[model samples]
Target chain A: EADIYQTPRYLVIGTGKKITLECSQTMGHDKMYWYQQDPGMELHLIHYSYGVNSTEKGDLSSESTVSRIRTEHFPLTLESARPSHTSQYLCASSDSWMLSVPQYFGPGTRLLVL
Target chain B: AQKVTQAQTEISVVEKEDVTLDCVYETRDTTYYLFWYKQPPSGELVFLIRRNSFDEQNEISGRYSWNFQKSTSSFNFTITASQVVDSAVYFCALSGTGNQFYFGTGTSLTVIP
Candidate 1:
């Protein structure tokens, strides 16, 4: 089993509320990523980090922001949650510093903004 | 631009039957990588297999196998004697230039027992 964990497996919040989705990995991986996926749809890369203090935007633009202050923790925060942000958020980690490495994923957090 | 396409949106197979998932990709980079991931109803992705661009050899593990063909730009997955537990959404991905990964629109497989 993968050591990666996402807190609050399910969340239901009202619009304009502040929400933070936490992701932590105990595997000591150097690369981490955040993806947004809808039911029966493809996963869209929203954010990723090469390492601590390194963050980059992904192919799909997102309103949420991610921070990589610690190696094991990568947190995503939405300042003002909206109905559009209601989707499943997936967190993943890769051991390899290079791309194309197989990634281990955590049980995604399903968010619903009312 | 790198893209992965899974033409079949859903596939149904009875227990002990075999099913193949089609994946076609487009990439200009010669040193790209193709991947297959399985996502059950639980909503977590499980890495099934990864194939580098230089390797065109077919790979098989247990009852699962992958066929990679550079000529057709396709990486297909086949499962033999599939069980009810094999029911899930399968996604094909491509990691091309800059290590960016692109995912397919997943194929939902239902194996009725």
Candidate 2:
């Protein structure tokens, strides 16, 4: 199994609340990504980080922000969450050998904003 | 920009039957990567296969096989004599030099016993 993990497997919160989804990997991977996906739908890249302190927004412009303070930790924060932010968030990590290396994904965090 | 398209939204096949999933991609990069991932009921994405653009050779692993055709810009997956355990949502993805990965909407396959 992959050594990646996501906190708060399920969350239900009222609107306008700040929330953060946690992602941690023990594989020491340099690349980490945050993807937003609706149930049974495609995954949209929301944020990605190449390494520690390196972060970039993905193709799908998202209201959330991500930080890579430690190599094993990449957390995404959403200030004043709204119903539009209700979706499953998947976390994945990969090593430098990306050509042949497949990304390992976490269990994913399911969020429901009221 | 790299994009992957899984035209089939859902497919149903009886157990012990064969099923094929189609994946079409668009990219200008000479070298890139294609991948297939399975998301089961557990909601965990499992890496199924990865094929680089340079490698056009088709691959077969047990009941799962991948056909990569550069001429048509298509990479199709075939599952022969599939079982109920094969039911899941399969996604086709593309990644280029920048470590940016893009995924398709995915095809949901159901294997009925």
Candidate 3:
């Protein structure tokens, strides 16, 4: 089993609220990513980080921001959340040295903005 | 450009029946990677298999099998005697540019008993 974990598997908040989604992995991976997905839809990459203090936006634009201060922790924060931001957020990590390996995914956090 | 396509949006099959999921991909790189992942209702993506461009040999694990055809640009998955436990959305992905991954929309499979 993968050691990746995401906190608050489900979340519901009012619009304009600032929230943070936590992601941690014990595999000591150097690459971490965040993806947004709707029910039964494809996953859209929103953010990723190569290592500590390195972050990049993904193919899909997102209002959320991510910070990688530690190898095990990559947290995403949404300022002034809106109902449009409501979706499932998935966290994944992979070994930097192995490009052919599959990414380990977390259980994912389903966010509902009221 | 790298892209993965899963043409079937959904499929329903009776228990003990066989099912196949189609996946077609496009990439500019000669050496790329193909992958399959299963996402249950729980929402976690479980890695299934990974195949490289150089190896076109088909693979089989238990009742699950994969067919890779470079000429057709297809990597199809087949499950024999599928069970209800196999019901889930399966996604096909392609990775050619380093760690960048391109994923298909996914094909939802429902195995009814």
- Identify the leading candidate in terms of lDDT: 3
Clashes of each: 0, 0, 0
Across residues B5-112, which tens digit of lDDT does each residue of candidate 1 receive?
999999999999999999999999979889999999999999989999999999999999999999999999999999999999999999877777789999999999
After the best TM-score superposition of candidate 2, give how far the Cα of residue B40 lies from its true spot, in angstroms: 0.6
Q: By DockQ thresholds, what CAPRI class is model 1?
A: medium
Per residue, candidate 1 scores C-alpha lDDT tens digits across A2-85 of 789998899999999999999999999988999999988999999999999999998899999999999999999999999999
For residues B1-113, could you state the per-residue lDDT of candidate 3 as single tens digits?
88899999999999999999999999989888899999999999999999999999999999999999999999999999999999999999998876788899999999999
lDDT of 3 by residue, A2-75 (tens): 89999989999999999999999999999999999998789999999999999999999999999999999999
Rank candidates by lDDT, best first: 3, 1, 2
State the lDDT at A104 in candidate 3: 84
TM-score, one value per model = 0.97, 0.96, 0.99
RMSD of each: 1.0, 1.2, 0.7
Model 1: CA > 4 A from native:
none
Cα lDDT of model 2 by residue, A41-92, tens digit: 8998889899999999987899999999999999999999999999999999
DockQ scores of all models, one per candidate: 0.78, 0.70, 0.77
Global Cα lDDT for candidate 2? 0.93
lDDT of 3: 0.94
Error of 2 at B107 (Å): 0.2
